[model samples]
Target: MVNRWASGSLAQRGQANRLSHGAAIMPVLLIVGGGLFGSQAAAYARSRGIEARVFDASLEGAASPAAAGLFKEAWAGKRLAEHYRRAIPVLDRLYGIRGVTLKNDDGEDESFQCVPPSAILEKKPVLAKVTAVGDGWLETESQRHEGWVYIAAGIWCQQFLPELAISGKAGAAFAFPGEQPGTIHAIAPGRQAIAFVRDPGFTHFSDGTAERDYAQEHEQATLSRAAALGLTDTPVMRFWGYRPYTPGGPVFRRIGERTWLATGGRKMGTIVGASFACRLVENELRA
Candidate 1:
């Protein structure tokens, strides 16, 4: 199956209206990033009647591709999980399941797999296994782990949206020290385990023409924090990606009149981004 959307008919139906209303006729909705969220948003929008475009720099700082790609359930919370459950059918239809092997936090080896309808009748059934974390489990006995697949965000986003945004940031990932289990790591809301400060004069990637070196500063700060967290020896892998920075709260805003800002998922960008896109189309773009 080509991993493309199936809503061309819907687009055809809306063609006349799109041509009629220029303001609402976003001949193309412009997306500013090419990470997982950006790519998925473009896909979901195109599947609807809306034309979507993505602009990406494919910079070293882009975070999605470098992410561990773990879709831990805890991140979804209650409301987001409901939204996710509602969106699952669409996601399953657009991108089906795959097989994977996962090691849970309890050091138990398990099978994780995405079972599309085609495998429903198979003899070997996929089963879920409980791990140390109350909500943690690995998809065992299918093919492989259920979650965590590479989306090729850079290529997929551009191939689907074919637009670009020129901004970047630095992000990093590190394996927990061997002493720790491979379960989901949870950080309490508003809890500051490590100390750091955003430069008093930090600039949003879209703000101004700015050139500042924060890489060393970031690395040193991260290392110091990791040391405090007792993971000093863990290897740190870095990535560059931009997330909307909002101290008040995360939001999806319309800048000026045409440009829309759908950024800032923090760590859950991929999960929430797709859901947000679906809602954006149904509520904002659908005619």
Candidate 2:
């Protein structure tokens, strides 16, 4: 289903709204970040007998910029098709946690096969456990597909909402395509573009004009930056997210032995920060 949000009502919460509690005094989850990843982690911890608390100073970041530029990943094959293929696993993680589901008009199941990243940067590999819920189908990489759109990138806490997202250190703009109701299709840009990890530990891509680049690139600098990044203008949410440089990372750091130190998340204050808090709590519990 192609969905786009036509109205930004005050009462409306994006798909990432906080879940309600079952009873009073849920265990404390203590998440340090506040973006999408942070929210998901906090929600995950909460479901596992923890109450979530996210911390970040900047909420409005580049992802929210009005004219932030964007492009699709550098995929060689059918770009959107390949993107959906690659996004299945990540979406699976999100679905497992969020209990999300996607189906065709006839209420039939949908699936995608092995999807790979458009380009592999020099970043560490990441993984999550996989389990087949229904009849398995063979994807090039792995089978067991569920029908839903997917995009591959590092997850973050600040990716939750523009408000919770720490403000982007760099300014950017995004042109949103309002197609289906409540769905984010694509984004056009205007500046140098911003690239960094979000608070939750996922990479962020957006069209931005660097404070420094402004002098040289002028009004339409984001287009040049977009081309340089090799982005392909795929149908993903134009959310640039924030860069929370909160007092230096391991946001939940310790100064002494039997202690931990955390801060930073130069860009990813949400997920990393919240993860830091949860890790600390876990260590403390173990201690």
Candidate 3:
């Protein structure tokens, strides 16, 4: 059965307001970056009859594509309890979550997988870098866009808001030759190595390494964990990216009359992104 979220009816309804008089002139949402945060904002905007366009240069070390798309409530902990609750419903409405069993050496574990960002985004991002931004407007190399501006630039967001102390935690996830059974093996007492089918046709593995000064040793250690899982074949692909971190926690706030900034997804990009997207569209934008 086709899930309502994945159906074309929602897209058609999203465009319904465009045909209305006066509403047709509503400001378009100009989003910077095409990673999880930015894409989620765009998707939510579309659902609410707000037009949105995403500008992304597809810079190296983007975290969204590398994400395993797996998340659980425990990962959010107590501090992010509200975000976890808000995000799950939005994620479920946009992209149905599937429960999967993860086999571990000690026992079995449970996790949930949301569809990747590429699957939820309504359109491909315009391959451009936003050169400048202000209240309700932003400029690229040759064109200027005027609308509601949302900056979800991940770690590179520091360039836009120089005063905010933002940093990147880097890591790599490797994909082996063939499909493998889902498993989570302990890499350390608190850390675990994950082997799952994050993408079709490959087995994805990551050792949950998050380091500010990521080096060759970190990469080797991740590979070692994959080897311990008996995945010794030459990795078919390697995904390297940085998860943005803020001193306090995830950030979502209005920066200008019509501009909002969100980042600091860290290891919880999917949930944080969806939660912020809801706040941006439902509360901030519409209200």
Candidate 4:
């Protein structure tokens, strides 16, 4: 009664200040690498109203761009059945999967593809190399950032968590001048080689090759398979990259209070990335 202004105006100001402070301290997701895992995480974070930024050095031998973007539930097998199920919805929502039939000598193979555009991330990556990371912060050569750090550095993730036994299976896919009809031809007895249009204006070919030591012989073998599909002409481009493999399976784990790590996509980078993205955004961060 004696001092109404002091109680009323001061109380409103205090509430506003607290709200502002809370907003200021809200965690941003700091993603390292701009490949499938990092990009998917950034996209999911934005959908959940969490700020996110990607840092990538755009190092050669990243597997995401080279991926055929083809997948089927049967390919996941028993171990990754749950991952396949969880990944489909997120992939459909973010990138829009489409059904396609892969014609082969035996018959036809039914599968789905999600060919994300070249610019899949919301914004361009920071284009900086992340030199170090901790519980809630990361540093580039020139600056430091504080946030919920996520390391999705693909094969290079071993540099951060040295205890984890990570290895790379390197392979190459070739691209011809024009789009070719979709087909899958037998490369080996049970394995199939795919020759189809993945990127627009180019025909793509890849035999299921994951070699620890990629050599000219491996390249020749891939080319021989491509020739079997009548892709004999000199290729306009070759996509070479390393797929990361872990001992058990794909990894998605929290390493620190505000830090997480994920890798080991292997041949299933697209599905694994999307599934981990959903888990990180919908479960871990939100919880």
Poorly placed runs, candidate 3 (over 4 Å): 1-24, 121-123
Model 1 C-alpha lDDT per residue in residues 15-113, reported as the tens digit of each score: 433445454334455454556565666677767756554544444555554343334355457745855564556455556545434443355654433
Highest lDDT scorer: 3
- RMSD, candidate 2, Å: 19.5
How many clashes (backbone N, Cα, C below 3 Å) per candidate? 22, 75, 0, 0
TM for every model, in the order presented, reads 0.48, 0.33, 0.89, 0.89
Could you tell me which residue pairs clash in candidate 3? none
lDDT against the true structure, each candidate: 0.40, 0.31, 0.83, 0.82
Model 3 lDDT tens row, 14-122: 4533755536557789999999999989988998899899999889988887787778887788978899999998888888786766887867666656565456553
Worst 10 residues of 3 by lDDT: 1-10
Can you write out model 2's per-residue Cα lDDT over 141-229, one digit (the tens) per residue? Answer: 24322211111112232232212322224444333232211112123432223433222233344443334223334334554544444
TM-score of 3: 0.89
Candidate 1 lDDT score at position 223: 55
Worst 10 residues of 1 by lDDT: 130-139
Of 1 and 4, the candidate ahead on lDDT is 4
Ranking by lDDT: 3, 4, 1, 2
